[model samples]
Target: MVFFPLTHQIPIPNKDIISWIFDDPKYYQDEPMYIDAQTPSHSISLSQARILVKKLIAGFHSAGLQKGDCVCIHSFNDIHYPILVLGIIAAGGVFTGTNPSYTPFELTHHIQTADVRFVVTQPEMVGSVLEVAGTCKIGKERIWVFDVLGEEVPDGLRSWRSLLGVGERGWEGFDDEVMAGDVVAARLFSSGTTGFPKAVDISHRNLVAQHVLTQEINKKPWKQIRLFCLPMFHVAAVPIIHTSVLKAGAPAVIMLRFDLAQYLEATDRFAITEWYMVPPMVIAIVMSPLAKNYSLRSVRNVSIGAAPLSRESQRALKGLLDERAIVTHTLKTTIQRASVASYQIPKQNHKLIDDNGNEITTYDTPGERKPPSLFTTTPNQAPVYIRGPTVIKSYYKNAHATSQTLTPTSSLATGDIVYCSSTSQEWYHIDRKKELIKVRGFQVAPPEIESVLLSHPGILDAAVIGVKIRGEECPRAYVVRRPGRQWEALGEKEVRRWCEVRLARLGRF
Candidate 1:
């Protein structure tokens, strides 16, 4: 009982990501493509972006970057982030990104798992990155400081600009279908069912397919000005900011970090027509007093994803927008597109199965949803799997992890539980089959936090779980005190303070 897309399949372009972007005439305009929200003057037009990307491609090649080599960017969102991503792929290197807030321990895991050969980081993050680089055996020569806003590089450190060659080197575009489908463009880390971050290999074909399918389904006649407040490292932001926005000829306002006041001001200042956000940001807008201070009348379309937004919250958020504005809820996984409207996407199909590995054809019945595959699985609140062109074929350098998640026919085990409504023929999300916790929009694995907590001498045993806190999912921890009287003095406040310094903001319990 495989459910196919309601829409017809569209032809996906067979070209490298860079070639697909540059070859499109729609993206050839001189208008601003990426604008720094804080410093409006610092913006890059399409032509300027192309030249910078070309320079980066040449730079990467000069720096001994070879095909399939991985280069990591550990920095806050910037106007030039997209440029760096494109440059890496254009040069036949795999681009990976890390959370800017990651501590040395977390950064070490990312660097080692991705096999990062080169690192581009902000001056402020250079210390931690360097520390992690040393732990990962990456040399100082391969690490560069990226002053995204200012031209002055920190003393005694090479700037990312130094990688740029004097002239652009010609990029050999991929015309072969097999090459385009197999070439890995990016390696984004995701905590799958294993509750440990594993590198997911996103091929050039996945990028192109997603870009095409998204554009085909969403046909907007008006020019779109998009606000990018979501972290660039997340899977949700990568395809949209780097590929879709560029191909759609939209102007994106880049925010270094999510400051509510600044976000509202930018929306008003830029007259942002379309943007993507998570549920917590939506909740903030609806509940915050500052939301009324700025003008959000210009925003007409808002897409919320990463976590589920309640119907009540969705309705409340719409009141803050223009009268004609519509709020769309999407559910996107790291490996595949799991939107409620995914049935409209071309070449996509989904199905539902019960615990006995039987397909559930009856609508309104909750079952573990999976993409139709030759493999059988008996499993969540009932796990939803999806098969599509955008789904990754494997996990980078992790054949065991890949084997556990992907079926022989390439259907991805999404680890999401959902049910389809009989009347509307739409999917509804219930819960996750995986142990990963969704805080705001970020994925926080319990094992990662539990490991940190176990390191404390005061605690004998620790367990972490997700709990609904004020309309958002937050991590809650339970611990057992050690037998020693010295451990009795360890208070919750002290433990929390210790964890704050060691863990990322989202991972802190």
Candidate 2:
């Protein structure tokens, strides 16, 4: 008999994201639901956000954008971002977030790949966005600015606030007719160790499944005043901040951009009860001398994800912060719709594969640590493969990529090497599949960088590899110049500048 892990019988909420965000009529719709820590007075209530979302929906519909259309947001995280995202999904449009740091060339690829119908951006980024818009043929009228800081709006573009319809004339309720199984709610770009970034199609079912799983695992009821600092475009930020945190009706501070000093000050100032950070932030906390000055005693829980945290770092972090603070390590994959697959294991959903490509299912002896390709023939060692409801349905518009990733039975090849204890049934991570590079908690594909380098006219043959610089992983490139070109002609600084202009921020070494 095949063994399967049983999950807690939690009630899974199957509906559009708006319903979950505004579920409880009495769920604390107070003055400060989302706050800008830099400017305290700039905050919005849940009621206010709801009204804005309704107006936003009416605006999009009036502007000729229909259900299933793609709307791209190119800006930093703030109170308005979540409202815009939920509003897009609420209006039945697919929401896509472009990295705020991307250049015109890099931004163009995302806009073209997603077939974005409209764009919402901040004033500072309008120049590059306009350059891409010209290339992609997106009309200037379709572009709008938001989160403006008294900056003069460009001549042809409109403000996000201006898109609002009068008195919510075309507004509907929080409810929508989208089904759980179909309709991609969010499209996230993940460079899976090779090629250009592929769009991960996260369905309504996947988001709801994640919400249910998080609710079961985190049984604590709204004690922590949380902070959202991670890039809104990444898989890690959306589920934790948008879905799970909102479901709990907890108050949160949304940072427009992450500054290390500001992060520390905010923790001390707001008496932040919970710290949700990636490994890079935790590493900074452990290493920085400034960490000693702050009063972080109010923090009761610390959660780290988007990359692995070593046992040594975990121990150091625990000692640095309150030793009593509960620090938890979470695993999130972009292909999994930002779901907690490792935490929500349903038993038969996981499998271990050896070097020889054999499935391990049983244990013959106790304490037998055989390094047979490190494959646990006895359910103890090897790479992990996972299948679950929260796993994405497919890579949007890429059937070939989808077929390669999803197995015959729909299990996602996680490419994470792991092991399971026979008696305890606890899964332990050993190493990654040697293809991905985690730079400051973001995935960097070697092939993606290699392709960029190859595109540079000065380069002929190039190979890229991940190098560990100061405890964090960074991509290092080795290049061969063209036949007639010398190393002096194409200097290292020039090549580096070439890469900086073309590659995305995370893709840079």
Which lDDT tens digits does candidate 2 get at residues 343-382?
Answer: 4354236777665778878642455343222211234455
Cand. 1 TM to true fold:
0.81
Write model 1 residue lDDT over 220-251, tens digit each, in one string: 76568999989898888888898776777889
The top-ranked prediction according to lDDT is: 1
List residue ranges in candidate 2 displaced over 4 A: 1-3, 169-178, 338-348, 355-357, 363-380, 435-509
- Report how far off residue 11 is in candidate 2 (Å): 3.1
